[model samples]
Target chain A: MDAKETVMNVLKDITGTDLSDKMDENLFETGLIDSMATVELLLNLQDELGIDVPISEFDRQEWDTPNKIINKVESM
Target chain B: MVNIQPYGTPEYFALIILFLLPIIIGLFNGRRFVNYETLFSLVFLVLTFGGSKWQQGVALIGYVIFEVITVGVYARYRAKQNNTAPFVWAVIIAIIPLVIVKVTPAIEGGKQSLIGFLGISYLTFKSVQMIMEMRDGSIKEFHPLAFIRFILFFPTISSGPIDRYRRFHKDYVQIPDKDRYLKMVDKAVFYIFQGFLYKFVLGYLFGKLLLPIVAHQAMLQRSAFFHTGLSLPLLGYMYTYSMYLFFDFAGYSLFAVAISYLMGIETPMNFNKPFASHNIKDFWNRWHMTLSFWFRDFIFMRFTFFIMKHRWIKNRIRVSQLAYLVNFLVMGFWHGVTWFYIVYGLFHAAAMIINDIWLRFKKKHKGIPHNRFTEGFAIFLTFNVICFSFLIFSGFLNTLWFK
Candidate 1:
């Protein structure tokens, strides 16, 4: 699977909500995840997808949605 | 004495109503009359600071001048260049007064600091936040008058539902339409009544009446010990102190917010059914929300960034765990440099860490039924844990431990 799919799967597992069609929707804005869950998703991305996102660069506006998370991760 | 402390009694409400009536009438007629609002703010500020507590008044003036200059100078410097060293120094100097205030009592056998004033912590929160936002280029302009108005906004100066600089500025400059102003009036009236019920009635019952009774009883039985060395009346004191703490602080917060709404500023709410929290992390989000958010934004987020940028730790979990410890430890120290307060902070830090572990465990073990009963049980557990922490925070333990 691609990094995006991997990150999405991990997010779904972390938040226990499906986001297949809501890829572009903001995770926090849409209430799909919270701060703790955000930390979990970061760790999951690092462990499962080998994308070690520095928390410093993780602005909610920029990496808010699944697609945004995927884009940021793939770029890294 | 003709001096009055702000919101100290119901009598003060009459004066507030008398002064604000004109401003309200002007707003309804589509005129803001900023001068009236400014004048009333100064008058109320004087009432709060100009009484027997005039020393605090001097400290407040000196403190505001220092912060205004520090933030103004820093913003100007940031506008010219982006350098870490000077920004760091500016931030440190801004916080020096508060640090002295917090530390002095601990070291000097509980004597208050000379520079200490009421609401120093809240104002410091606002100032430090402004400096950080300026460094981030979020606060682009720093007008001296607007900055002063933002910091000295009277309703919340004593305690806060701490408003943001930009948010306060926007609200300050705009004249809410008649319809919106009326709606604000409705909410303001309701919140003021609620504040009376919360602060005057329930807060009096719990804090003024029952807390002292239970506390006295608890002091008498400090000798009893269980296997964990816990005592009986101490248990009673736990629930009593927790209720008193909530009612008193929540009442003050309600009054503050209600008055802000009266003045047409949408100051945020501080408590939202915090006892209903299912976990320690959720509790923090609900309780003293603005203060916690301030800490989260300034201390937790910045510490996380600093840690990650320096690569001080390789493991993300360890990095966050350490951040939580440092964040809460500073918060505890800020409350006062005492053992119980420090332990209270450490307890919450540990509770949140354990809560994370439990969440991870729950995620792995699907059989651990995700149902109402479990959720209710979680809430129950969290409530008691928090109450016990409040018991420690009440300094009854200090009476039991050392006295």
Candidate 2:
């Protein structure tokens, strides 16, 4: 799987909800993930992806939407 | 207790100059900002502490001094190897003060001043947490000076989201560009004024006017209409408190971010529309977010790890329940050392544990078990439950069971 696939897979595991296409769905707003789950998400993204995302990237805009997070991850 | 310079004289002017100097400096240049944040914070330590509120200032200074020393120990350890926690030492130092004030019964005239220790509790935690992160190698090894600014940075100096050293270090080092710095300064100034509006205006109105009036009529006289009337307004006041909480905290966070921005340091956004949360768990995640993150990372993460590692509480109640109990209790204690705070945390933990059980029960089926209206109803109930817990936590709502 590509980077996007990896991110999507991670999100699915995280939210227990499908996000095959709706990448812009606001994770917190749509009940996909709560703040507590965010800790898991950050940890998983780092451990699974081999990418140590600085917590600074975990801002509202960047991490709010699936697409945004993927965009942030790709850029990093 | 936000040390507002009493409305008069040179002190007010001095405070304005202190805040303004940064803004002016920002517009002109962003160089020397890190130094400024550290220098001004130190100046704030001396002048503001020694100014009108010398007692509180001195206490803040003492904590800052202790936190610095503790962080230094961690920094020294890092020079040799990873896996040390200077914050552990600092927390011990902090607990000394917490015990005297908390353990001593008030009847015998215990430590009479919460104001003295106002900024110390939060700052000490922030300081030590950062040190621990440094030892854990989560954050880049910080210059001892920059770490000091991270601890005593004045924007969130009064009440805080309990910023972590790693987060602060991350933000500090990764300032995007000159334009980004300028944009942050703009946002930061906006937050400073916004902070003023929330704390003084909205908060004062709710606490002084709305809540007081309703609390008076409702408590003094007993009638359903009066009770309902008082409760309804109190709900509105709760929203006010919610807004007050957001603007007050987010405002301060912006100032810190902005100040740190001018210093070319990044700071995390503490609030992310938490009141819009539809669940108990979501609210905790959004609200007082820095505090939430701190408890999760340090207390909850560490405690849960320890419990599981040691097999401490193996009552067949499921590990999830244990997680909830420990998480909430620590979260409550993080808010303050008071009994009210403990109950407040437990209340949240219980509600969340129930919410989790409900989710698991629903998970037995397929997607979309509840209709939108039903979901909305659940969200409403959850929100109120949380608001009520916070009200109790704030020590405003007093009832026999709550204690």
Candidate 3:
């Protein structure tokens, strides 16, 4: 799968809900991913895509959306 | 040998504002008088640490020198290579003074440590944060001068809304434009007035005036309720003390943030509408936001990451629950090494665990009703739980039972 698809799958796995339709929605605001889930998501991304975003660099505002996550991973 | 507490009296405020006038004008004229600002900060620091508090002043200087060397050495080592052992040592060394300060009182029959000074906990927080960030490679360079200024930025020095190093560095290096500076001035003025209302008026009413009366009344009823000191007056004391804690701390935070603004540094705020929170988790997000956020990022999140990486706990829920317990227990200990503080930590940990369970259940059950009434009830329940925790935190229970 592509990076976007991989990220979407990870988000769905963490939240237990499909978030493909809400790519721009804030995962934190919607209660889909809290601090715990955010770590899980990061770990999953590292395992799946070798995208290692340090916790310090993870600004909640910048990475709050699936699309943003995809973009961040792509940029990295 | 005049001693002045930050925001302690009308005279202090008046003197500070007069000193600040030139910096304010300089900002308006699109110039930052860096040297003068440094001089102003030194004068204030001397005022705070001079005279009767000279011992603390000595301690503060010693503590800052120790931390700068510790963090500086770590930063230099981190520049060449990544090693866990050195980083761990750096963190432990950074906190040794604070540990000594905390443990001295507990072991020595309530005698304050000679090395202990006001805002020691806060300074330690900043130092630890720097070390952690350095390990992460986010703070790549270590400038001792900048670090010292960040640690001693006099406005929030005594108590902080806890400004981050990078954020403070950015503001210190850049001057805000005229329009932005003017808006900041407006906000600063508003915050000063609101602080007056919260600290002088409400804090005085609840903390200085009403708290003692309620506490005395509760003590009078110590013979009631199996001599447990559980009475109606005790409940009143809980709510009153909670209000006092919020107003006094929040008021002080407002002054800190306001002064930082006047200096063209945008310090983070400490409180939002914390009492209106719908759950314990939400309450933490709103209350003493900087400290809680600090704990969340450094302790809770880092602990979860460490355990998960090590595969120590297979269950994710268990991992998070353990993190909460550790996070809050550390926070409790940070407040001081006392029974009430420790219990306060454990109480919050339990509350957080229970809150998570309810959240998960509510998420699963779509049949649960959602409305304003339920939201209100949730807030009411959260508030009471928090106040009870604060009562544990207040050490009044210790006084009632042991003293």
Give the Å shift of residue B6 in candidate 1.
2.4
Q: Top TM-score: which candidate number? A: 3
Q: Candidate 1's residue-wise lDDT over B128-160, tens digit each? A: 988888877778899999999999999899889
Instruction: Choose the strongest candidate by lDDT.
Output: 3
Q: What is the TM-score of each candidate against the true structure?
A: 0.89, 0.74, 0.99
Q: Write the per-residue lDDT of candidate 2 for residues B1-403, one digit (tens) a residue.
A: 3345321233453565566576456534534465555566566556545655767766665656665666666666677765424446545764566455444444435446553455655665676576556645666565767766676666556666566665666665554556776776677667656655655566566656666665554444333453433455556545555555555556556555555544555555677677667677777777767777766666665554445446675542355466778888866665656778899878988987888777766765667557888878877787778677766665655441232
Worst ten in a row by lDDT for model 3 chain A: A50-59
- Each prediction's total of clashing residue pairs, residues at least 3 apart in sequence or on different chains, is 0, 4, 0
DockQ of each: 0.16, 0.14, 0.79
Q: Ten-residue segment with the worst summed lDDT in candidate 3 chain B? A: B2-11
Q: What is the interface RMSD of each candidate, in Å?
A: 5.2, 5.5, 0.6
DockQ of 3: 0.79
CAPRI class of candidate 1 = incorrect
Chain A TM-score values, per prediction: 0.89, 0.85, 0.95
Give per-residue CA lDDT, model 3, range B97-134, as digits (tens): 99999999899999999998889988999999999999
